[model samples]
Target: MTGNHNAAPTTQNSAADIEMEPFTPHRHEQCRRFQIVSASGLSYEIFVSIPRQAPPPEGFPVLYLLDANADFALADQVLERLSRRPEATGVAPAILVGIGYPETEGYNQPRRHFDLTAGPTRDPFYAKTALTFGGQSAFIAFLQDRLKPLIRSRFPADSRRETILGHSLGGYFVATLATAKPDLFSGYIAISPSIWWDRDGLLASLAVPSPSRPQTIRLYLAAGSQEGETATGEQNAGTQTSAHDALRQRRRMIGNVRDLAERCKAVCRDAVDLRLDIIADEDHSSIFVACLPKALRFTLPFSSAD
Candidate 1:
């Protein structure tokens, strides 16, 4: 629904008695949306997709999705479908809550850059872009202090089975969150995370022991096979790779995520079970779509013991 959300509904026909919000409602999903303002008075569009089935006794697990304006529909659809055949797919039905900005259609790039990153710094290449950053902490605060509680209060959310899912910068946000608040969610799905966004050493700090930890730390890091920010190595039989390309590939979206998994494994092996996926034939833009199904599998993983 796109209008003055604070205002009452309206109609233009002289004989019309009522008018409804403009949303084309989903036919099969119990989905709804509303506007919320945070303690800081930042208004957000909260998109929710609830399971059609009743919750389990312990309650349905909740998977919180970032970059909702872009990925929420995908998550909502894939999660609902796979969940229908959980016995085979191993993806249980769960509540999918998308956090997104008001007054945006797709990615609100400016808001995301600030909301998902951890530092005001950037790679030299970005120096010319003059991009501002470093709002992950405040964003996490909104999730922890307000959003999560609101969802739990209103839904049958499984407290012990909460998970976070994101892509790219959103992925970066969750990756950084694991180090600072490892116990905030039971699991994380960071697809093609911009691991290079380490100006403040968020990735490095993963190896550092935290005083607290999640009861179970399952980190699923996925990226496309072609996610290198630039050419990975020398080209054309010893021809020197472009300096800029060489410099840019350092982000090594796939390599860095693998490296991240390895680093966390080395330090928290038993405590943190990690999985990394390099999906074939996808780049950063298409990678998340290709991986969404598998991502859902990870979000509500099958338990062998079960």
Candidate 2:
């Protein structure tokens, strides 16, 4: 969801009229970094921060994903903190696989536009940008076909204990994958997904029927107070704009997430656990940091014996 080298913001820089506010420090946790490479012929990096002083056992729970950029470090730290609690010992050792941008010029925007979208459109947001915006299908192929294999080769991980995390645009891809390929993961953490993407076309994609009986999937969705900086952020049918635009956008987005979650549940309620967290006093950027601990607790909870 985060772009690099101060690349152009995803939308027009009209007045910061719709710009959301910053995050409170109380919501953040410390994090660290471990590196890995992507299969896209790019020497990318992954950040894997484990719980402090946690012993390596038979196997620790794992989360593997893209968009490690910066927020992922905090996510690693948050997971580390959560894993140390008495209720979370088994879960804290969770190994995070953060896929970083390949260190190359113009690498940030291309990956952002490509890995986050499904396909092309003539909309203003993407019409003038590079043509690499909708390579999510290929990106998913890379994760399922290459990155997961590489991680399994390196770690003693149980495929059933895997979780995937992504924010904003990355969250969009995560949602797309959950609906399109539900069996690839056991849980999903999507922080403030870009529900406004492609004119909200992603929701329609979710309505597609499944070939096999849908399996129960663990899913969490969250958004921040300042998430609404554009049409994508919040909507007000009454007031044009007000002090509540950001909050409203976050609410609307969360509502959409809940609605989508319910729709999926209708198909396979026995197999799906969908949760929504619309955190207070956070915006787009700080949301991942705030929700990290909760995400870890919910996705990788420990069992009594193990």
Candidate 3:
């Protein structure tokens, strides 16, 4: 059949009639958003949630959450609800700040990889991927130099009560921060931290005394019961039978977390209030939600003696 080449093709439906919903402003009442530019010109979307109750005499404790785009909702809800009933959970009201990228979904993968890892990975598998690593120092500088001051200027944040929460690579960053700059935050929560990164570089670094050590610091470490467990129930199931790299990776993750916790206790026995927890039946992905409540409680304990 001869056809006109310039004519528009016929379709089951017309495209011109479709209409999109008008944009509406939907904001979280408890949260305030801020666009902060770091010294290096990286823009961050920071979401801060102040406590509903009045600040304590010393000012409110601040929880600095990593991977904020993904974790802020859960962390904010948990803190808000638990803080309201401190008698039960022993978690007091505090300021919650989520540090996230400017225009991204749950995570800006490349940025996260670069900003979270302590050093470049030697893993053959990861080496094949295009992802970069070893921007953690710069990211920490941004936090210390720009973000903290911005938050302090706007909120009544208690510098002595600052806490940091991170999971997976974020968790790795938290551990790196703790060892490299112990005095940056008073409390550190590492949930299923990627301790297997960069040939366990972070753990190796922590072996020696940190140049900047805090006299008194609280460290909470946690891993899931099934963190490194295989479908066949083998833990740390290295490449013995199958060639699945994930199994060995998972094993490394679980082992590293435990090892890091023990090392922290041994190294900072006198100065660090280290707590290790393993949530049963939870794996790498599920452990954070399950353990966040406990972590928050530990970080913001009520002054029962008072």
List candidate 1 segments past 4 Å from native: 1-25, 207-214, 229-248, 302-306
> Per-residue CA lDDT of candidate 1, range 1-306, in tens?
342223343332211221212232454647777666555545567887888888877788899999888878877878888878788998888898899877888988777887787675556667777456766676788788878887887778888888999888888888887666677888888888888878248656775334465455778889987666432333435544577456647676777888788778887767776788888767778888898878778768755322
Cα-based lDDT for every prediction: 0.74, 0.62, 0.75
- Ten residues in a row with the worst lDDT in model 3? 16-25
Q: How much lDDT does candidate 2 score?
A: 0.62
Scored against the true structure, residue 129 in model 1 reaches a CA lDDT of 70
Task: Estimate the TM-score of every prediction.
Answer: 0.83, 0.72, 0.83
Would you give me the overall lDDT of model 1? 0.74
Worst 10-residue lDDT window, candidate 1: 12-21
Summed over model 1, clashes come to 0
lDDT of 3 by residue, 183-281 (tens): 788899999887777535676666433446645788888988776655334444543356554556644877887888788788777667788898888
Off by over 4 Å in 2: 1-43, 50-58, 86-91, 104-107, 121-123, 199-201, 207-215, 225-252
Instruction: For model 2, give the 10-residue run with minimal summed lDDT.
Output: 12-21
